[model samples]
Target: MSDGTLRLLLPRFLRRFPADLAAIVLLVLATGVATLAPVISETPLRVVLGLVFALFAPGYAFIAALFPERGPAFDGASASATADEDERSGSNLVERDESADAHTGLTERADPRRAGSIDGIERVALSFGLSIAITPLIGLVLNFTPFGIRLVPIVLSIGGFTLLASAVAALRRQALPVEERFEVPYRAWVGAARAELFEPETRLDAVLNVVLVVSLLLAVSSVGYAVMVPKSGESFSEFYLLTENESGALVADDYPQNFTVGQSQPLTIGIGNHEHEQAEYSVVAELQRVSIRNNSTTVRERQELDRFSRTVPANESANWTHDVTPSMTGERLRLVYLLYRGSPPAEPTIENAYRETHLWVNVSS
Candidate 1:
């Protein structure tokens, strides 16, 4: 029923250290930042910041907990008096000079169960474990939520670790006696760590750290590689005829008059790369034409030249147009494209490249 018992039952933060209540504030800030990340970033920078903040949250909590100030119970005169009484009791033993030394030794030796609490280390380890477990779960849940696409679990993990570190720092600052709180223990821990570095027993921890670091680096680099490299063998090419009037039409007027019948006329050319790869040159086209000739014996011809030159990259397409006029004098005429492939000057083979029109054109004498 005493205040001391009541204090022990309540959370440390509720009992004291209200002014150093920065951890909660930081948690709120990080949450807000993460929520607004999609709005703020055209790139994924907001997501990156959100992840960083998530990692920082626990650390922030730890640090806030570590702020230097003795709690009210520990700072009071009653605690000091208790220490003085204990010292006086020790002094009394020397004055008696009986087998008191032996008796004191017996009592001290008997009280082997008086080891100090490992509560601080336990709390830190518990916090670390909880942070690691919960953050990933939260992140996974967030991913299923509407905004989850932007908020990944890795970011959440970062935030969780940050919060954990902050909490440890804060607990260290607040729990231990002034002289023994951080400095001495930290130095001792450091010395032990240095010694352990050379110890064979510590190799497992080192190996685990290395594995984690490597995995993280690999994941990050994989994302970067995906963003930078083009996909292979993916391209598109399209060609459409643009008439002189801007209407989508292909007519004899669309091409030079000197373009001879039977000789290829360039039509619209288009190239596209759908794969994440580059093509030195590729072409695709859409063609339209009307052929006219007065004499039935006149030769009617439509050919596409192989001279056009261009390049296409993965996942993209281009378009170009060419016109053809028939030299044949024929009452009825058909329009089509003679497709060619390969480098120019040398004849390019046209296997199935021709697109013949179903409609017949009437030639006027």
Candidate 2:
């Protein structure tokens, strides 16, 4: 916290500047973008960015931490060449009587398990595979927690894991010698890609490069267009009725079977809007006297009880309580609810209602 403490820590922090700082910075940026983008606006950019971050970054950081040493790069074709190069390099060292003993001592000091260490290509491939494996495992673990696999918990868990792994990787890399640390030579890769794309040798190669660039551009444009302008799906609404349980939770059970005239019963009405836009809805509650003969029912009389309206946004729901008071006494009376998209007609019948629900009850005077 003090100036002297800050000065002492600053040098140590910078003493071994991380070679993979760009990757860590990207992971942090992606986490922030995924977290804030949806709150700011609904866009597919966040989905794409978040998908890449979730499917790659965490595993890559974990792999980096596990393998901080740059493994030997040798293939079948280059084995002989690498051996000859090593022989030539060894010829320059000073000759001494203890050279054999020194070689044996060095070999004994080296870790034999490191002989199976992986190179950059294997690390990258394993990073992607392990990410796919690890992400679902994290979700599975979260399913049992209080969070129950929600967005905020998932993001925090993954983001925190990635950051911790990146820190561990940095520390591990710093512990190794500078030349032995595993680092991504992104600058060199960029330079090589630029040269391959723009600085071709022959006319044929230049023409091929141009074609490749155009193809890449077209592919990117197509994917971006699809993501930005997606087609709308089916639009509909849901209407349901519920009653309060002993736990104060709304459930579709325990309806009042018998109701006295002028007495009130409590019930809940719920609506879910998936219309892809804000919607204004009207609900009409009524009690009807019906005569049933040979399983054919006919409404003899209808009495309107209550009317309610709600304005709900897309992909949202609304719930409200309504009291049902019967003024007419009858046996097996139908307590009906009619839902309309807008204002209901003078006669809101079941045939014309957008949605309808009813419960048969007995009313006594």
Candidate 3:
């Protein structure tokens, strides 16, 4: 950009507070992470980042919605009294300077406290509290929608709502004149804080001193633990079934959707163990009527079609080439491969599953 453009742009952007800029970046990043799933394939990273966005972004926006203007002083009687006192002092300082000076009557600066709207500390704390309270409600609402609280939908929806709230806040703030703008009195607040730190005047001061010390220690310990703690390499398992077709050899899962009752279907079941240890596994294949109602799956007439067992080591894989056939035909039937860590049970459910996958088949009468 040209020098003229830079000069024009700097002041406008600089007027935005650090928190506001942070909110903007977070909102954009949240949406980006949700939309670009392939680019950020690491599930853990996505989950952590998503959590950060949820905890901070909406809360920050909610704070903005409530307190659009940020300035030196807070509202209420104490703040009003402080403002009046500061204004008087500034006036007196100006008067004395003007009378003493030969020229340029305005020698002393105006009081910074008069420019503020709320307590910065209180605003920050309140925002965090509100975010925690509001996030679950937002999730509840998302549950009813088609998205159903998945990564992409939740992130995008929350990010959009947060941005909208922030925009409303900025608009409300802009309604006021620039001179009367409510803003955090950064310099005055910092100076007062530092001065109080050096000379404690109240009992609260002593308590705060202890709190700060403890907080510092905790912060350091948390960082050290994160750095030194041993990581258990990824523990997981993968299972799938495959069958051949006339087109070529094919994965039954990805290709064939139709099946026949009492017709022996030649299929290969494969399991890859990344459980990071030697373990025994059980596979209970079932033909059941699976129906989803009100976000819950209802299984009925579960017929155990096949059962298999194997003990596999870490990073090892096992495969079984066998035939599986359904003895019953019904609408909305599923050929479910329920994989468990131990011996096969009389009945199988996902709750005790180490890994599970399914094949939806159209069983013709």
Candidate 4:
């Protein structure tokens, strides 16, 4: 491809600005990491990158767009002009002390407004604040949309906003004069940091710097560990039986109380997987003939009706309809469902099953 075509293909904001390019790259990385984190590695890289992207990137880009020109504190050109004028005035005052009028005129002519505009510190604080405010607003808007506030929607919306804001910031910066544009002093910061750590004036100073660095690293490690490897909650699964109502909705109340021999009756069995992983379940339906003496019940005989197996995802529910036909006629027959996490043993009983539910019904021939 031609050089111009390649340049044209790239974003306009990224063409000439290193800061914008870096911001765009970081945003893309964060988005990709977050979107693919579940499918990719189990490392805490996603949390780290996602936190930065969610908390800081959007606000910083927005602030940059709003204030493309260098802040008052870093307006070197304006500071230089004022410094030059002061120097000239001081020299004039030194040379012409005999003339009170000349000295007074120099003092009055000096610029009074020393502060130029918002500085680096304010910009940073504002960026954080704006980001915190903007992100939730984006989420709120997404709640109203068809996509809702899901992972993909949230990531894409925030990332899209950040990208657009960064582009606007870059364009605004480009419009400003070269000297007036706000630029992150990456090289200056690195040089200063290097000097502070490597070229400490005394042994104590060096030792203190090392301690500070270590403390920062420890703090970061602690946070990463906490976020990356969270404690697991109580693992459990929900098992229930449901019956279709007159309105065709599944309800727990309309259970079948009577069954005919060789006649199928519809019953819905549901399994909610809360085990934090995919689980395969085996459900065994049995028609039990039992004898009740006082409060104690003993099974005389049991007939297996149907067997069902299902694999359910974590935090999801699976429902299946089964037709229960009693092979033996009896009064107060126990229609039992035994749910096992894995393959059921040779004899599946209520006590052996991971979950168990039963209904009392009478069978007629």
Q: In every candidate, how many clashes are there?
A: 66, 0, 9, 1
Tell me which residue pairs clash in candidate 4.
72-117
- Writing each residue's lDDT as its tens digit, candidate 4 over 1-365 gives 99778877878745686565476557766667765777653566676777778888889888888888777665554556555777886755556667656646754553222334467899889989998999999999999998988878898888888888887887887787776677777776798799999999999999999999999999988997898787779999999999999988789997989888999989999999999889999999999998889998888999998887999998889998998878899899999999999999999988899999999999999
Candidate with the greatest TM-score versus the true structure: 2
C-alpha root-mean-square deviation, each candidate:
16.6, 6.0, 11.5, 6.3
For residues 229-301, what per-residue lDDT tens digits would candidate 3 score against the true structure? 5376778888888776677555654545667777777678888888877889988888888789999998867
Which run of 10 residues does model 3 get worst, by summed lDDT? 103-112
TM-score of 1: 0.29
Error of 4 at 208 (Å): 1.4
Residues 29-117, candidate 2: write the lDDT tens digits: 76667567756336776767777778888888889888887665523223445446658877433465486567547544542224556
Question: Model 4, 316: alpha-carbon shift in Å?
Answer: 5.4
Q: lDDT scores for all predictions?
A: 0.47, 0.81, 0.69, 0.82
- Per-residue error for 73 in candidate 3, Å, reads 4.1
Ranking by lDDT: 4, 2, 3, 1
User: Candidate 1: global Cα-lDDT?
Assistant: 0.47
Candidate 2: where are CA atoms >4 Å away? Answer: 1-39, 71-113, 243-264, 292-297
In model 4, the runs with Cα more than 4 Å from the true position are 1-13, 17-21, 37-41, 76-118, 129-149, 227-229, 240-272, 276-278, 287-303, 313-336, 357-365
